[model samples]
Target: MEFKPVTHVLFDMDGLILNTEDLYTVAFQNIVSQYGKDYTFELKLKLMGSQAHETAKIVVSHLDLPVTPEEFIAQTSKEFEKIFPDTEVLPGARCLIEHLSKHNVPIGLATSSSRESYELKVNKRHKELFSLFPYKTMGSSDSEVKRGKPYPDIFLVAASRFPDKPKPEQCLVFEDAVNGVKAARAAGMQVVMVPDPRVDESLRTEATLVLKSLEDFKPELFGLPPYDD
Candidate 1:
């Protein structure tokens, strides 16, 4: 299928831009293990692109945990505080962001994280790289984003924040979750998925392109300028 020339780009955080997924896995395991629950990839995928409360609720319900959502949030927040500061940017994340910024391409970040969580995960280690995105739409905090991933609210709101307000067809999204890929397509945008290796191959069919890492992304295929190096 042919894609329109993409003039703008949107990015998802967490697994897509940062190496915080493992941190979350450890946090969830630490919490759920008390209840004799194993934190599995299937559960992780369900929580991947969900909003904070939604994720908490899903975990609580799925595992039949005795804790309330509020308790889960508080516990997870504490765990994240201990580790999110150590969060690292994924390979090629800085390179791709800088490359697009240098070429004057409009770029934005649409993350399911709340402003509080986003700050803890990125502000401390990658402030310079994060600042490159003029539009940082924190879905869990944005009043305009009524729904999380698997829904088009965040991406649509993110696209609207662009200075020139590019159409969904003129924008490309980079996501790392099944729900995120579905959301981007629902918003009428093409999405490149840099998914975890363990994600089911069948789930990958919806992405416009799937790569093992951002390092494998070829900007010129979407009409963006190629890397000079």
Candidate 2:
């Protein structure tokens, strides 16, 4: 929690900044259900923030279903599109992004979500602090970063976005999953995990600061804002 001399704010989209985790759950279940496999809420919680490839393997194993990985991914992805219209930003997420944008910190988004999906969804808000631009970022499919969280590919991509811009230690990452925390940490960045209440306590251990929610987040705690603010 102490490492708040932040020059950059890196974010994870699905669960941390947006309420798309449950949507993913619903979509995934619907997709798997069509194939007669059981995909539950608990399964989605276990699989959030992961790459489609990583998730398909688990889905196949858990449901005891037999299918090619590529087939499962394609089917689930089609289901996600049907559900993205129902997604919404999380509480305090808009204000947090607005506040940071007003401060002009270089911000980047690191997500396993495809660029097309991010553009369709995140661009609708226009509150995103950075794109793959002069500000810097890396969308999925742009890089060969094969592994997802618990593997640092995404966070590494985020930190490297503005390579000549800010140092990794000077960046702050907001995450809601243990795998995301592990990703940020492995990227040599400090992480504050604002986990969904449904995620268990064991996952919170990997975070540098495990707060209740972004509502409880105070820039003052990191000495970024004056006490009155």
Candidate 3:
């Protein structure tokens, strides 16, 4: 397949870089279980890449839980405080980031997590690896991002922050969510999706490229420097 060359890259955090999606499942299950509800994978598919408050609302409404979205967030926040620090970096994520930084390619993080949530997940264990991003657009916290995934705001904002302010077409996005792929495409950027195995094949069609894991990505295909190995 022919791939477009890109000058800059944007990455999604939760499931793409960190293994926090599983952690979030654990946390959400803990909260919903209290209300005698189970957090289903079908529901998780819809929540991926949404902002914290948006996720809370969806969970509350979908499960018919009595709690308000704010209450659900508070409940989940407590659960997250316990497990988020333990988030592991996903395979090939470190190598890819380091390679991009080493090649002097402009890179930024675009996550639906708020700054506080980002700190919780990154500051403890993955600080050094995440610090490689010159800037990160936290969709829940960034004033410029009026909307989260499924909307182009976050990716557009991330690209604008690049020193050269790259055009949307000049940017490539790495994502692990269907909503994120839509967002990147809506922004006119190419996206490489690394989706969970449970996600339907039809959902993968919108992405410019689909791979099982970041380990499968070949940077050379996108005009980025190839690994020395």
Clashes of 3: 0
Model 2, span 89-184: residue lDDT tens: 887677776676666556777777776666655565543433422343334465656677778877776677675656767778888887789888
Q: Give, for candidate 2, the lowest lDDT window spanning 10 residues.
A: 127-136
lDDT by residue (1-229, candidate 3, tens digit) is 4689998999999999999999999999999998899999999999999988889899999999999999998988899899999899999999999999999999999999999999999999999999899989999989899887899999999999998989998999999999999999999999999999999999999999999999999998989999987
lDDT of 2 at 158: 68
lDDT value, residue 206 of candidate 2: 73
Report the alpha-carbon TM-score of model 3 versus the true structure: 0.98
**Worst window of 10 by summed lDDT in candidate 3:** 1-10
C-alpha TM-scores of all predictions: 0.98, 0.86, 0.98
Global Cα RMSD, each model: 0.9, 2.8, 0.8
On residues 1-229, what C-alpha lDDT tens digit does candidate 1 reach at each position?
A: 5655799999999998999888999999999999999999999998888999999999999999999999999999999999998998899888999999999999999999999999999778789889999999999999999999999999999999998889899999999999999999999999999999999999999999999999998899999999997
For each candidate, what is the lDDT?
0.94, 0.72, 0.94
Higher-TM-score candidate among 2 and 3?
3
